[model samples]
Structures are given as structure tokens and as C-alpha cells.
Target: MPINTRRSARISVIGLRGIPDVLGGIETHCENLYPALIRDNPDLDITIFVRKSHTVTITNEYKGVKIRAVAAPQIFGVDALLHSLWCLLICAFSTRPDIVHIHGIGPAFFTPLARMLGLKTIITHHAQDYLRPKWGWKGRLFLRWGERMAALFANHIICVSAALERDFLKIYPSAARKTHIIRNAPSSIAGRQKPDNDVLKRLNLTPGRYILAAGRLEATKNYLFLMDAFKRAGLDDMKLVIAGTFVDSRPDYEEKLKKQVSENIILPGYQQSEKLTQLYKNAALFVHPSHMEGYGLVIAEALAAGLPVIASNLPVHREFLLPEKCLFDPDTINELVSMLKRPDYSYFLHPVAISAQKNDHWHRAGKEHMRIYRNLLPNSAILTPTTR
Candidate 1:
């Protein structure tokens, strides 16, 4: 490894499909986090590995961080496995990063190979990917195996939320010694950026007259439940806007959802940046019906935008300390419809849930990540050894 004038380490990040406007939670996390990292530590040379199928740009850089797009096939269950292997091979022969940070359990399967090639590995346990409904038995088994590989091989593991850390430790109890909760923050809201309402105006949506939900149209998100509830609620002239794209694994999900939507229900696929912020800030209520989430970052973002949020009764939602009334059981259409019918939403004005945004948490996340990176480096002094 050749030393640069000031930089001490080179880190390679993998597992998310391209970023800066990509659709997944992991993509958003990387988009916000890596930039903050290089901004704070000018000497760190970070190269992110993005899937060629998902990347839109030919550029090699993003906000001081080097972007290396790798060729990955556009298959659902196999893409991650192949992409990670390709990246690890590249790390071994080409770029030679001091550390390879693998995001998500699916990609963490290659951690052992990375270690075998003398590369330090850090795996961020974004979620219990095995538990997601998108995967079949084979996929589930593979993801679980990936978790085991990560537990046994990675030098350090970072879990996004404490609940997620708890869940992962339960499965791989011995891995607890090296695992740490670094947390995922909502987009910064120290002072709000001006909203872009171009899409809103085009869609004929008026502020406070619509209910907004944002996330991929997956079974775990329970979009069908939300749509059914909205129809049953039948609040006159109040529209429902679901601002997200479809999941690749669930192509039929779009057709199923389309059959149920009326003129008032909007499906503006994959909103981000100013458009997403506009939707968040202007909605009468922001709802997240996800049955499983690593850290309900979308809920936190809604809270940050000063929007009232109603969510499914997931542990992650409860982790936000939201009041009972704001959460509803997804199985019971009546309960959700009742929530939709509530005339006044001012009861949701609590600061406890919005704390992630109030604090510049992305900056904190970047610092914590740097500490872990430094501690793992050869002969580096940053933190003491982890206790079992």
C-alpha cells in the first residue's frame, strides 16, 4: 500500500446499489454518511462500490468520496452475492483498501474471503435481512449463513439501532463482543432547506389535504393494508399519496396495488431530495406501515419535518417512544381506518421522537465510524479493545 501525502487509510464500501438518488434505506445511509466522513477527515481516501446496473452516472466522485461502479447483474437474490465477491476480488488485486466495510447481511457473506486475503472487514448489520418477506427459504438460508459468516469473520460489526443489535446478538451471541450500535440518523434539520414543490403542484396535491407514505412498495411495508384502510376510512376529499418505487423481487406487487388505487391515491415512485422533503413537510399525516425495519429512519425524517406520523406497531416504531394512538395494528383494517379518520393530529407533537434530527447525528455517526476505522487499523490508537 502506497502512502499518500496526508491520508493514512483507504476504505472500500460495498453492498448498496448506486446512491445519491438510489431507492433503498442502505443507499440513503451511505449517501449521507460517507460524504460527512470525507468532509470531516480530509485525509481519508474512501471508495464506494456501486452496482453498474443501478448507477446512472459515469462520474468517479461524489462529494470528495471516490465512487467506483462495479458490474453487477440485475437479478434479485444473486446480484448481492456476485457483487460482493467481485468487490472482494477487486480489493485483493486492484484497489487494495486497508479496510472493506460491507453493508447488509447479504453482502457480509464474503467477509471471510476478505479476511483470508489479509483485508480487515467491518460489517454494518443494517437489518435482519433474513426476516424480510421478499426472500424465499433458500434466500433466507443464504442470508442467515451470511450473518454467521459476518459474526465469525468480520473484525468489527456496526448495527444501526440498539434493537437491531439486540436481535443480531440473539442469533450470534458470541459476536456480541465485537458488535457496536452506531445508529442511523434522520436527514439533518438544524435549519430546514427550502422545499421543492414542483411534483406536488403537478400532482394537484394541496398542502394538508393528503396523507403521505414513503418507502418501497414491498410486503413488509404493508402498502395494501394502508390502501385498504384509506378506502375504508372514506374521509371526504382527503387523498392518499404513497411516494415510493416498487421492489424488484415483487413485480406483481405493483399490479396488485394498482387494482386497489382510486383517483385520489397517488403512487409517485421513488421521491428524494427537495421533492421528498416537500411531500414530508406538507402532508396532513405521514404514515409508515413497515412491519420490519432496521431503524425506521423515514419515521424520524417525518418527525423532523414537523409532520405527524402514524406507523405500524413494530418494535422500531415503539423505539421512537410514540404515543399509543399513533400506532395501529396492520392486521386490523378497522383500527387503521379509525386512525385515518382522526380530525386533529396535534397530539403527535412530541420532541422525543424528533431528537435524531435536532442533533447533527450524521456528524456524530461519521465520527463514531472513523473511531472504529482507526481502531481497526494496524498499530493505530483510537479506542481500547472491545470487552466480551
Candidate 2:
């Protein structure tokens, strides 16, 4: 709650399915990041532009950050681009924000548009979507173009993981000077939810009798890989709970995953309530076998909840979880099976989980963003209510 200046910066945030615990990494990032920014810096005027399809109501604000909804197609490829363009148009014509901070590559395609309209621009590369299996040739190409545009046009680029910063620099060497690394922070709500056994009873699951894997049921998420490892481990008494929904963009993959999973596997779809919280709290272990990530938020969440994590041996995961105790090669079922078969989960409890829980705070992340915004607009001050 510090005021750094007298003039307020009007910031318009774009790119996301939507917020208030939507079922994606970027949504979770926005949900945690913006609220903290608002609570700590009253001088900053923050408005988030959202996709209308993601929500049921026309609410104007959330946790003091204004919300502006724009029509976006529910389909996959078209949704991000079209929604971003619409948000850009509104920022250019109506809101006229001092800083237009766009999240993710798809929306970064509009960075040039924001700059052309005399708005300062910032883009956060949450993940390299082009690397994900869900995207085809055209989608990948467009995302690549988005990276190029963001590198060339944005005033500054923020990467949620150091791995992303390295990956972006490999393709856009010129962006090295402007790009920055700011890892996503966990919300205070991480371990605050009261333990609910009702969730276990309703799902016909017993406490501490299940391994958890939570992410959108997509190919790149590699949920099937986890299933294979679990099957090979042959922990029949221990159930596997896959807690995410298929977005209909990958219907074939979804159907295949459903067919492939065994009797003990649970697909509860997307969960955001006490059930999800309870799942995280009571799980015997948390596993993430994603082929790619900007940052693994769920892994961090699991660590925060004091749940042991067994994740893909990706650099991003290692950045948070200890290399020796928390990872296995994502491509090899044998490595994952070995990890699953290990009887002791205590190795993940100490320094690895404790470190993640300690550092992944929204307040720290908000302050970092404030520093970036301040550096971008050195003379800008906080906006008073009268300015509206």
C-alpha cells in the first residue's frame, strides 16, 4: 500500500479466457496478479478486458479492477486472436489506457496496433503455445508471428518463467534488451481454504488414497502419459484423479484419453470450488507430466498445499521444485513409473515444497509489476477517484 507518485497510470489488461478462477494458467495468473496490484497500489487504474464467452454475467468489476467484456468466438484458433483484436480496438478508441499490458502470444499480435494508437505496450509470454500439440501448422505460424510482433513492437516483454525468456531470445535476439523474467505468483487463497471431506465423499474417494493430475485434458498436457505411468506402477489401491475439462478444441484426443484411462481413473472435469481445494489438500501425491509450460502453477499450488509433487523434468519445473526429488523425464514412461512406485513422498516435503510456498506470493509479483510500470512511466502518478 505504497504510493510512488502523484500521477496515476491508466492500464488496460488484455488477453485471457477470463478471470475469477477460470480453468487455465493465464486466467489464474490474472486472477492472482491484478487483484494484488489493485490492493497495493491505489494510484494505479487497472482495467481488464475479458472474453464475453467465458462468463455468464455482465459484471463491471472484480476486486477493484474494472472488467470490460468483449465478444469472442467460443472456438479455439479464432477465439484468442479475435478477442484480442476487439480488446485492442476498445483500448484504442474508448479506454485509451496509458499502458496496454497484453498477456500471452496470441494477443501480443496486436502490440503494434496498441503502439500505433499512442498507447504504451507490454506483453507477457506465459507459454509458447506453438510448441503445444493442440496447435496445427497455421496456428503455430500465427503464434510465431505473435512472438515476432511482440518482440518488435511492445515497450517491454515479461516472461513468466526463465525458460520462456531463453526460448523467446533464441528466436528474437533483438528482444533480449527489452525482455524481462517475472515468474507467476500464487494467490493467498492457496492453502487458506478450509479442508472439506464432503468433496471426497461425493466423489467416492478416500482421503490420501489418490494421485492428482490437474490441467486441461489436452495432448500437450500429456495427461495420458501420467495415466500410462500410473498403470505401469500398478498401485491398484491408489486411484488417479484427472481434474480438468476438455475444451472441445481437442475432441478426438479427449475421447481417446477417456477410452484409455482405467477403472480407478477419475475425470471430474474443471473444478474451482472446495472440491478442487480438497483434492489438492488430501492427495497422496501431485503429478504433472506436461510436455511444455511457461510456469507450472498447479505444481506450485500443490507445493503450497504441502502436497508432494512428481513433475516432468522441464527446466520450468526445476526452477521451483528441486531437481533430484521432484522430476522425471516427461517422454519416458519408465522414469515416471519409477517415480510413482517410490513409496516415500517425504523427499518432496522439505526444501522443495517449502521454497515454492515461501516465494510464490502475489504481493511480491505485484510489486515487481509496479516497478516495471514505474520504470516505463517514471513521471506517472496514481489516479484519484475524481479523474473518472
Candidate 3:
């Protein structure tokens, strides 16, 4: 590869289904992160390869970043595998992107292919996919193999959480020198400035009269456990609004969840923009009951909305400085129930800590990402970090 300081560095992004209204954690991360990256560092050229099945847009640009739609399957396991491979082949055969940035472990497994094609690769380890219950033995093995390949092959690894980076280095100590931790920031709440509360009216919800839990509706989210805990909490007047979409691959889990939904337990399906922000703003208490997470982006969003949270005792929860009392074991329904009924929900929350820990995290993240891109392709004329 030749170094050319006159031209803007080109970054090719993969490992996500699609963006701009997409639901998953990686989708949300890309939607916020890339736009900010280009906004601050205008010289860098970023292009995301979207899966054709999830998105149908003809436009090739979003928020100044270039977009290229690639063919993708709708099957659960095969979809990600083939779509990612297809994109990699395009990179190998056609595109001359300076760096190929892959998000998530499932996609990261293909990093060796990108490297073999003479492309520089960066893997963003979103979470340990092998830990999720959705994967069978073979799937888990594949994910594990992917993790090892990424750790061994990629030019640099970017872990979303300190916990993720720490655990990764422990498993692949030889890869320590290449891995870095670039935290995922909370998404801005769009509903905060909405003119009307019509979305709440549609759901028949009153402000401060609901318990909110938002994420993809899957078994890994522990929604059933949360439903049971909320039932026993005895908040008869307060409704539990779980705002998320059901998984296409897991019909049995979604079917069982729907059967258990009573009048008080509302499954409003997947929501976004002002609707999602309104859900966050109007809710009394926010609950996150998940078995696994890389950085827990929704938990950060709930806090950013000034809503108190009750989350699982994952190390990522502690990373946010969530008090021990606010953290409950995912398996312990009784403990979550007890916390749910407490009158002093906000007392344990550290509102000051939120700003103190990370103020304008996305802006800083954009700058940090630019720094990384510069390091890899020094001749690309990337922006230098601005002084405060």
C-alpha cells in the first residue's frame, strides 16, 4: 500500500445488518458513532456496507458517510455469515478502502480473510456472542473460533467495554499489544424535545406511571424474568412497558412471551426517534435485566434521560458507577422485586457521576477513532484532536 497524505483516508465498515432506524446494539452504535466521526474529522471518508434484506434505501449517503448495499440472506445464522463474507469478497476484489472496520465477534471471525486480501482490518468486539443462549454448540464453537481469529489476525482490536478488553487480553495474551478500549456512548434521546405526547396516548400510558425496559425482545434480555419480577413487585397501578422488537429467529420465545402478556404488561414492539425518547422520558423507573452485554447502551441512555435504573450485576453495570443496591443478580427475581417497590429509587443514583465520568462521550469517541485511523494510515491527512 502506498501512503498519500493529500487524500482523505477511506474506512470500510462491516459486521452490522444495517443502520439509521435499525434496532440491534451494533446498529445503534454505528448510527451515532460514524456520523459524529465524519462531523468532527471531515477529511476521513467512511462508507458502511448495509445488508440488502434489512434496508431498501437507494441513496448511497447518510449523514455524509457513503453507503453501499450488499446482498444478504434472511436466515438467522447463515444471514450474518454469508452477508459478511460477501462484503469481504467485494473488499478483496474491488474496493481499495484503507481500513476495513468490522463490528461484533461474529463478523470479526472473518478478519483473517480481510487481512489475507491485503487489507488492514480492525475488529470492534461488541460482546461475547458465545455467551448468548441463542447459539447452539456448533454456533458457540464458531463464535469462539472467530474470537480467536480476530485476536490473532486483525491489525488492531477495539473492545467496547473495559470488561470486554480485560477479559479478551486474558484469553489471548499475545494480542494484548494490538487491542484498545473505545467505549460506546449513550445515544441522544430524540423524544426529549417532541412537541406533543401523542405516542404515550397511543399506548394509553401516563407519565411516571410505567416501568420501562427497552432492548431487542429475546431470551438473552431476560424479559420473562423481568415480567415475573414486575408482577410480584405489586405495582398494580403502574404498567410495565417493554419497548422492543421480537427476534425473527426465535418464534417459541416470542410466542411464550406474548401468551404471558397481560393488560398491565405492554409489549409496544420496536420503537425509535421521538417515540423511543418519549418512552424513556415518561417512565418512572428503568429496568435492565440482561445476562450479557458489551457496554449496555440502553442502560446509559436511561441514565442520560435522568431516569433511575435497576440493572443486572454485570461488570459493565459497575463500570457506569451504578450503586450496588441498584444492581441485582439476573437470576434473583426476589431481589429485583424488592428494588422495584422501593420509594427511594433515585436516592442511590449518582446523577453527578454520569456527567463527571463521560461528558460528550461520542465527541471524544469520534476524536479517538480519528486518532486510531491516523495511526493505521498516517498519510491519509486525518484530523488532529482539537483542544477544549
Candidates 1 and 3 compared by lDDT, better number: 3
Please tell me which model should have the higher TM-score, number 2 or number 3: 3
Ranking by lDDT: 3, 1, 2
- Can you give the lDDT of residue 189 in candidate 3? 60
lDDT of 1: 0.83
Candidate 2 per-residue C-alpha lDDT over 115-189 given as tens digits, one digit per residue, 9 for 90 to 100: 888889999899998888888899899999998999999999999989889988998999998888988776454
lDDT (Cα atoms) of all candidates against the true structure: 0.83, 0.83, 0.84
Q: In model 1, state the lDDT of residue 248.
A: 63
Candidate number achieving the greatest lDDT relative to the actual structure:
3
Residue 267's lDDT in candidate 2:
91
Q: Please provide, for model 1 over 328-349, each residue's C-alpha lDDT reduced to its tens digit, 9 standing for 90 to 100.
A: 8878888888888888866656
Error of 2 at 38 (Å): 0.8
Q: Which consecutive 10 residues in model 1 have the weakest lDDT in total?
A: 379-388
